[model samples]
Target: MSKNRFFACIRSSFFSRLLMGVVAAAITGTACAAGEAWPKEINLGYQKYGPLIILKSTGELEKRLKEHGVTVNWAEFQFGPPMLEALNAGSLDFAVTGETPPVAAQAAKGSPLVYVASEPASPQGEGIVVKADSELKTIADLKGKKVAVAKGSNAHFFLIQALAKAGLTLDDISVAYLAPADARAALERGDVAAWSIWDYFYAAAEIQLGVRALANGEGIVNNYAFYTSRRDFVEQYPALIDVVLDEVRKTDQWVKNNPVEASEKLAAHVSIDAKILEKALRRSNYGPEPLKPEVTAAQQKIADTLLAIKLLPYQINVQDAVWQPKGK
Candidate 1:
C-alpha cells in the first residue's frame, strides 16, 4: 500500500457500512456524541492482549477486507474500556475488550455494542500476578499494598474478587488504575506490588519479568475477553460482522491447532520469549459461543460485583449484548 493510502486507511475506514472515524475529542459510541453521523468505512480497533493480535500482525484481515474495498483500519489500544471509549465516540467500528469494560460502557449509556465472539475462560489462569520475589503471596497479602489494573477491564474484576477472597475491600489496597503498559512498567520498576492483566501482556510479564501470579482466578471468576462491535455497525453491516467473527474464529482455530507456530508468532509480535509465549498461549482458552449462558452468568457476576461496588450505575442487560449469526 502506498504511504498516502496507508495513512488514509489508518485515519478512517469502512467495511460495507462499518466506519471508524478518527477524531480529536473523547467519544463513547458508534454515532458521534454530537449525533454527527456514522461513516461508511470500517475501522477495526484492537489491543495487544486479544488473540487477534496474531491475525493483525499477519496482515490477514486487512488483506481480506481490502478485496471488497472495505479499507481496514487497525488501531491498537492498551485495554478494552478505552478502546470502547473510542468506539463509542465513533472513532472505531469494532474492537475486542474484556467482559468488564463493555458492561461499564453499557451502564454509562455509551453502550451500543454487541458481542462478536468470546474466548475460552481459564479460571485461575487469568489473574493478578506479582514478581516471584515479592512478599505478596496471596490475596490477603495485598491489603494496604498497591494493585495495578486497567480501571474497567476483566483484570479489574480479578482485583475485586481477589480482594474479596482476602476478606478485604477495594479501599484496602491502593488501587493504581493504569493501562497495561503503565501497569507493566510500574510492576517492572517495583512501583506497584501486583499487576492484573490478560494474554500477551500477561505472558510478557511472567516471561520477561519472572512475575508469578499471586492468586489464580479459577473459581474466583472466569476473566474472558470479548470481541465486540458498534451496535449500529453490526446492524447495518451484518455480513461484515460475520466476516470479522469469521476472521477471529480462523485466527483462534489456528492457535488451537498450531501452538508452536502461534507461540513463535505471538512472541515475535509481543517481543517476548517463545517459551513464555507458549505458556500464555496455553492459558488462552478459546470458546465457540461468545454469549453462551454460562458466559453470560460469568459476565453477570462481574457486573453484579461492579454494581455492588458502584462501578456501574445499574444492571446492564448482557443478554442483549450478544450478536448471534443471523439464521444460525
Candidate 2:
C-alpha cells in the first residue's frame, strides 16, 4: 500500500485500456476496407459478335479494370439464351444479349438477373433465310416444313411474329431447335426449309452460302440487345457498372463511326470474313442507354407472346427485373 505501488498500478491500467482502444480502431478500419474492396476478377459473357467483341479485342475494359486491381474473364456463347443461363447461374457478372433472352431469363424461377442497359433497336440485324434455290418463297411457305431456330433467341421471337403475320402459328411449322451453326448446316443440307438467325451468322450465311432472306426484322421486331447483370452484382457494384456502361457507350460510338474498320478488328478475333461482318455491322445500330418504359412495354409484349405460345413456362413482369440504379 505504498504511494509508488499505487501510482504504478494506475499507470499500468491506463496503458492497457489505451492499447485495447487502438486495437479496436485498427480492426474496425480493416473491416471497412475489406467491405469496400473490389473483386479480384469479374467474368463477362459475350456472344460471337457485337460491341463486346470489339471491346474485348481492344483490351480497353481490361486495361481500365486493371487499374483497380481487377482481372477480366470473357466467356463466349453461341447465342443469348445460353449466355443468360450462365449469367443466372452466377458464372457471369455481366452479359449482353438480344431482348428475348432476358425475357426468358426473367421468367425462370429464382432468376437473379436485372436489365442494366439496352442498345438501340437494329431491326435489320436478324432474319429468316432459305437456300437460294428453295421453293419456299415466303414466310407463309414455311407452313408444315421443318424450320431451324435457336430456342429462346431473338430470332425465335422474330419467327413467331413473322408466322403470325402470315396467318400461321408455331403449330403450322415443324421447329427444329438448333444452335446457329447446326441450323446453318441443316438449312444447307435441305434438312430444314428455313433458318432463323441473327448477324453475323445471318450475314455470313448469305455471303458464304448464298442463302436468300425470306424476311428480316424491319417491321416485325425491334431486335434490341440488352446489357444485363446479376441483381446482386448491380446492387453491390454500381460504380463498376457505370464504368462498364461508359466504355460500352464509347465503343458503340466507335463502331457506328467506323463500320468497316470495326468489322476488320472484330473479324480478326472471330475469324469470319471482314466483308460479312461489315455488311452486318452497317445494318446494325449501337449506343447503350437506360431502359425506357416503352422498351419495357415492348419486352412485356414479347413475354406475353411467348406465354401464349407456351415458349415460357410462366408469365413474368419485365419491369420487376429492371435495375434501378441508386437515386433513380
Highest lDDT scorer: 2
Model 2 is weakest, by summed lDDT over 10 consecutive residues, at: 29-38
* Tens digit per residue, CA lDDT, model 2, 1-328: 9999999999999999999999988987665443344778889999889999899999999989998888999999999999999999999999999989999999888999999999999999998999999988999999999999999999999999999999999999999999999999999889999999999999999999999999999999999999999987877677788888999999999999999999999988999899999999999999999999999999999999999888889989999999998676
Question: Candidate 1 on 62-140: residue-level lDDT in tens?
Answer: 7777766677778888778888888778888888777788888767675677777777776645768998888877889
RMSD score of candidate 2 (Å): 3.5
Q: Which stretches of candidate 2 lie over 4 Å from their true place?
A: 1-37
Q: How close is candidate 2 to the true structure, as a TM-score?
A: 0.91
The alpha-carbon deviation from the true structure for residue 38 of candidate 2, after best TM-score superposition, in angstroms, is: 1.9
